[model samples]
Target: MRDLHNRISSPSAARRVTGILAAALLCATALAVPVTAAAATTTGTSDDATPQLANGLALTPPMGFNNWNSTNCRAEFNETMVEGIADIFVNKGLKAAGYQYVNLDDCWALPQRDSDGKLVPDPVRFPHGIKAVAAYVHAKGLKLGIYTSAGTKTCNDAGFPGALGHEYSDAQQFADWGVDYLKYDNCNNQGVDAVQRYTTMRDALAAASKSTGRPIVYSICEWGSNSPWTWASDVGNLWRTTGDISDNWSSMLSIFKQNAPLAPYAGPGHWNDPDMLEVGNGGMTDTEYRSHFSLWSIMAAPLLIGSDLRSATQATYDIIGNRDVIAVDQDSLGKQGTVVSSVDGRWVISKELADGSRAVVLFNETGRPQHIATTASAVGLPGRSAYKLRDLWQHKNYNTAGAVSATVPAHGTVLYRVSADRHWASYPPAVEAGVSEAPLVEAGTPVPLTTTVTNLGRTPAISGSVALGGPQGWRVKATSPTRTAALSTGRKLTTSWTVTAPAGTASGAYDLTLTAAYRSPTGDAARSELATIAYVVVPPPDGTSYVSDLTWMSATNGWGPVEKDTSVGESAAGDGHPITIGGTVYAKGLGAHALSTIEYYAGARCDTFSAQVGVDDEKGANGTVAFQVWADDALVASTGVLTNAEPAQALTADLTRAKTFRLVVTDGGDGGDSDHADWADAKITCAA
Candidate 1:
């Protein structure tokens, strides 16, 4: 289990085949793991099975402290550590914030079972036995959670009983020991189907709880290999939705991106896990940890902290103990939030709480701090009204009209609760801005922009008029739907603008501002609503057009996403060497051995093409990275391998007859370690 956090992505060849087949079939059926014990429950479907028998358990996500995130199967898990965890949880006010259960993950048992074939705590690690630790936790008003594998052996190959053929007996043992939770992991099971193997344990646990009257929350750690979200809801309280997450910003972002799509699968009883919270692990900064907490809260993930509570800092305690953020996770609505929008590396996620308010997170996953802004419509908020927004972290309140905006630090997050402002004067109308074309418009191109002023107020506005403005030297004109328009309640007044930048305008974000005024029913001047929209301007697509600014790849990320950036950082943290040439940023993306697609409509006019590629790590990095060019999906040229320590490599491909080409970046094998890839100064020469 050493560095098992990264092993989630590097599955064995056998797992790869089975994973693809299982994923392709979208299999939801679990094979029945038989139990011979008379008191054990047998096999059944996920939905009407054992969970209903144990109703209303884990009604909200279980808040607890688990050893795996901090110790990683490395802790000397004797009675002392368990008691210490409970003491910390109580003394540190974590229990007040809903963090209960001291969970011991993996490697607590001896090398072999006793003569009776029953699981026993290792005498060396637990001289007083498991019951003593449970008693201590219970004394501190906390619960104890035990760990087991679904396979024949535990993850550490400790030769511990995985409950394979002993589900009934092991469940009975755990219940008798006063365990309140069980983290059932997938380890060396010799190719057992996850659904069936995990299901067998679920049934046994239910039977044990029914017979012994000891309720245990079941957590299946299958690592999302079989799409556990499709069926794990009825089997366990939570299921791992992706590979293990390391205590790094990149790893956290990667897991969050993977788990965002499975939001609908999560609810009151089941959640989509992105592994454990690596808060207070010393692997990331405080800002990053806050972002981690915010993302997890917005996602409604289990807050099973993976940290050394005894040694954690005050900031860590504040982050993990934020009751306001926790309220969103344990919101009665029980809905998980998904990524609503991504702009300039800024991601917006919105979750609806039970009280009808929305928990919104503005996350910046970029190297540089950014002003993350979006229209109410983007977050599915009522676009025609004002929202009384509260900054959950800062404890500040804002009367936001129209567009919601926040300046977030690099790899930081801003968490807010958006509620309807019932009072019209307090929550006034707002103006929203948009453009007809993509952010990147060719230099000198005239783009049509629109701004809508709405009464997000309890009453209507009299003599409403909106004025639009943009940068000087750009000929800008505007027209309102109706000048001096008297807007009715929830009615919108529309305005449009046509603006053009000079031919020599630099290509980047250009802001367009708006000022709207209205009179109150009493004929007095009312406060105005203002907004700003940032639109990107780009030069005409020349022979070697940069892919980063291209509409096809810029805003998106992941499987086929691409970014135009010059930072050599393995991650967006701005690491490595300055590799960009004659520009501020380079086109960067990642691939999982498979090609991350980059479309270049360079056309047939290109006579020569070349690019410099390298792994974006401090030189000699172990992970392999490569760049490939494709003509109509057919490989043209590839810069075979570039390790982090190596200088950027150059590649040239034939495009005499090709009009469209794709740029591909690959992990090059050895998993995605240091696979921070870069296509620095990638350009093409045209027949001038």
Candidate 2:
């Protein structure tokens, strides 16, 4: 990969001088071999230079497996595991997919150094030593990566030698052991300046590479404390932009948000590292992993796999081996993708490819499918030009003359490679729309239904009208029906209609239609319509089966995430936000009690109160917490000391028949350690 960046310099100084003279003599011939985007954007060149210096090995973001997310705190970092992983890479086809390094994150070293102050591999774990391990890995056609800290002690009690005072010796030893990559971490720095400390090791690694004729990919893992992207590129190949990522969606998305904006700092060898990949980890769904991969690719982030390869599933292979997607990350442009347009939980990102094509992604992060549409102009492509739209993942090709629209499923993505060509003569006028309305509506109430229609077409819509149609008995009135009908390209018009459900409408899901019509120069009219905007109609309250809409709560808030459970299994994310505590997998109520609360109204037609509460973090030590149920100003029921390992505890209160109730979660003075509280199956029963 490094050779791909530039022609190798001749070994002799005289030969290099000759090449320089030749390049000067034939400037046009020298320009024939184009400079790669990655090579030009070396960390400090213009954008994201790390505070620490980088070694410039990860010109494209590094791709490989790290052992952290899989083994966590208790890994027996050994020669056997690394060699076995090398075998799995070949047998599992990961080697063909470009995963090279088999990295040892931590705990691979003995707690104490040798008599000569040299780092030692754990005798029990690696009896044959790291050199032998590296040889085995290299023999299997894979590179070996090692980990250490910049301080005297590592973050964990791995007893690993910090590369502070022993930078030269450590680098020499790593080179001798055939270590191809080094993840220099930040822990126990003891007030030493991080920049100075990391640069010391970076220089040591360079010297070692020079002395040993071995190039090691240096990674600055200081947790982005010193803003490595601002300076690290000159010294290292990649730098950590954020802290670690949990095997969950929220944490993953948060990390991307932190890293994407630093795209400019990343090019060629210098990349903004967002930690490792948890693609095969069990904490998230397959859809979530897909989104995770998509975001990382566009961000030009490293694709380090952080799970056990020996037992990986097929879904994991599909995501990690996505060739088309990987090509985007490894694109010679070395461009990191940023969120260009975002609204209503939908995000669109575009990256300019080296081949003059544009890589675009329509991402849906919400809990349901989102209707996302964008024009070529919106994505920074030539709007008047026709392009070949290839769905990279779906393997489908389409001839789109206007805005590209897709119904991306929750946590799913639509990745397209748009390559321009002069094939079609005329462009169609496109009407793109977005509808915003309440998800639930009660009979006899009015709700705002707003739709924004845009002329995304390159051509103008000379005469047209945008309309909102609904059920026969519903009352609907639009503010500006045809205001944007005769607009030019890129023009937008908004129409808002107040809709009142019929007094006797049944409780079920109904569709609201939004249609936009345009007249062509030939006097022919064309229409684009969103036929179904799903809105649930709450039925008339009967003697039973009445549910108080949780969204109607006057106030609801929580620490961490106050997730609205659109479906069950929200608690499975292990974020302590959702958990099942009763017979039903109830997910709509409070989960995990980090000083969280959900206050709701019972209204005039209220009856009994019931909820099943429990703790969800079974892996951690149980903490003492209280889940108290309140009816207005009175205490109704309470579950005392909801321990982490405890089963579902029931709380049924006779509602004083108050018009309101609140679920208050409190840390029982233990400071909320492992207090994963869940108010599963909570309900306000209202009957005649």
Candidate 3:
């Protein structure tokens, strides 16, 4: 078997350079890519001739648990762990909420096959063999899924036997052992055709099902290398549309971008798989995880849990077990969501539901709060005067007069179930409110903030008033009229406020609330509240200071936590080594992976920012990345592309009066593989 760590690259520096140049062009244009309303033809395949499977299974994308992202080939990935997960599923409401399979990933079999050419379960790992484990899971009312490769050997360094030429026998063994699902991987195939290999296993599974009177769901894990979406619908119930997913925002975002465009290829029995769920893997925040779940559900992908349930948190369970969100994935319509609009990191996706409703997702991919708005007609909903909207995450319902909008948090998603209703006027007017201003403020300085209240309900809003409040010691006062006599449907009332942070305030994020109080024309009172963050910052003292030593307003990384004065490591804080770029070690700097950003509250006091940027030497010659420096929203400096094969390049940005400073690293267009980047010897000089 081939070592997974030594996987193939793009083959030449020229190709990498082209990828980098393309990425640079994208960055110059707000990272814009052409948005398609329907699935476009994939390379080398025709979707029109793609067949559909009649397996009578996975009519909806499978909802299950796979122990790969959380455990991989660790010692704890044994029978006990699998059974414990089944137990959690039953006892913790996951099974009740629709999770069924308790799946095993790689490393479940012995190193060699038995004398009769049969695979053997590792004695120490599955003491009672796989059949007993399957029985245990079945006893708990859940099914079991097993893993194997289509090649001569399975992935992983242990090199267990695969079902290359023995697909019939292996399928028979799995069916006899009561397996209900098979995750067919694509490693060590010796260059076999992806479709041919997968179809062989599909046939073998069908034969085994006929003989054993049991159905098995086939998942083709070819990692989308061969444009499986164009042809795999006939071969497997679900097919992976992208490479393996790391538990990070960048990986998830990239996979979503790849899968969302293939919406037209997915349906009742054949689904596009964007790998598995990483909801509770600990590499992302609760907000980001929610976005991941929402996006997956809207895409109509399989809902496979990829966390260790034995030690999972309540938040994790809550996210995975959200029946409302899960229903969108398992909708009887089975139509995948299409991108309604995507511009400057704001995405609006809409999926048609079975009950004459549409599931809408307002996703903010940027690094700050942004107001995303759309309309019922924009998302293919029938023209109506009013619509009923249910907020999936908040579990609240509101009435909208054709306008769908929200101030989504950074890296957050707002999901809604929108249905046209003639009786929407009976509900209270939906007055949406939000505040906008430069979030960063110098201590004791007043900043102008604008609060907008829009009446989106069918009825008119009467006596509408808006107010802004901050911390106890801070000052906030409205500068414009805060009340309106009558605001018609779709009309907005804008109010201005001057907010001042207390002098000597410590630098950090502070909470602020914007409240809009109104009454319907029928005399019913209604209120809407929005919470936002404001950063109070103090400039660094006179002289030069290491950037890593200063406080950052926000930090988002591609893989693992950002490191202070170190090289980026894998998925853990402070696990990195000394900051090293092209074999040179630096004692002071920030270590981050690609698709990362670190923002500082410069407070308009910094004069200059400089750093030596490159792919970290810790990745050897296997990483490619680009470095960018931004002053507020303007790009001040950039290094087009840097690979581990090149030496560090110097970057400097003028920050004479910039209030905020940002350091950004992006993947070099190919993908974020081993994109560990270093900002070595980073420094900022500010006046006292």
Q: Model 3 Cα displacement at 681 (Å)?
A: 2.3
Off by over 4 Å in 2: 1-56, 73-77, 423-688
lDDT leaderboard ranking? 3, 2, 1
If both were scored by lDDT, which would come out higher, candidate 1 or candidate 2? 2
Worst 10 residues of 2 by lDDT: 1-10
| Candidate number achieving the greatest TM-score relative to the actual structure | 3
For model 1, residues 1-688, the per-residue Cα lDDT tens digits are: 1244233343332353344234323311111221123322323444455444244677788889888766665545667877888988888899988999899887789868889989989877788888889988999888999998887777663456677888999999999999999988776667777778887888899899989899999988876767787677668888877655666655677667667766767788777777789899876778789999999999999998888887899999999999999999999889888667775678888998888778889898754445577655667666555667677886645455645656565577888887765653543333222233222344578766665666544446778777766677877777546365677654776767677777887645555555667765656665442333334433225555544445432222222123445433323433334444223334442212122445554445565567677665432334466677876446789876667666667788877666556676654532243344666666666553
Better of 2 and 3 by lDDT: 3
Candidate 3 Cα deviation (angstroms), residue 144: 1.3
Q: Write the per-residue lDDT of candidate 2 for residues 275-368, one digit (tens) a residue.
A: 8888988767777798899889988989999878778999899999999999999998898875667776688888989988788989886544
What tens digits encode model 3's per-residue C-alpha lDDT throughout 412-463? 8999999987677777777778767536777799988888999888888999
Residue 98, candidate 1: alpha-carbon lDDT: 93
TM-score of 3: 0.90
Q: How many residue pairs clash in each candidate?
A: 11, 26, 0
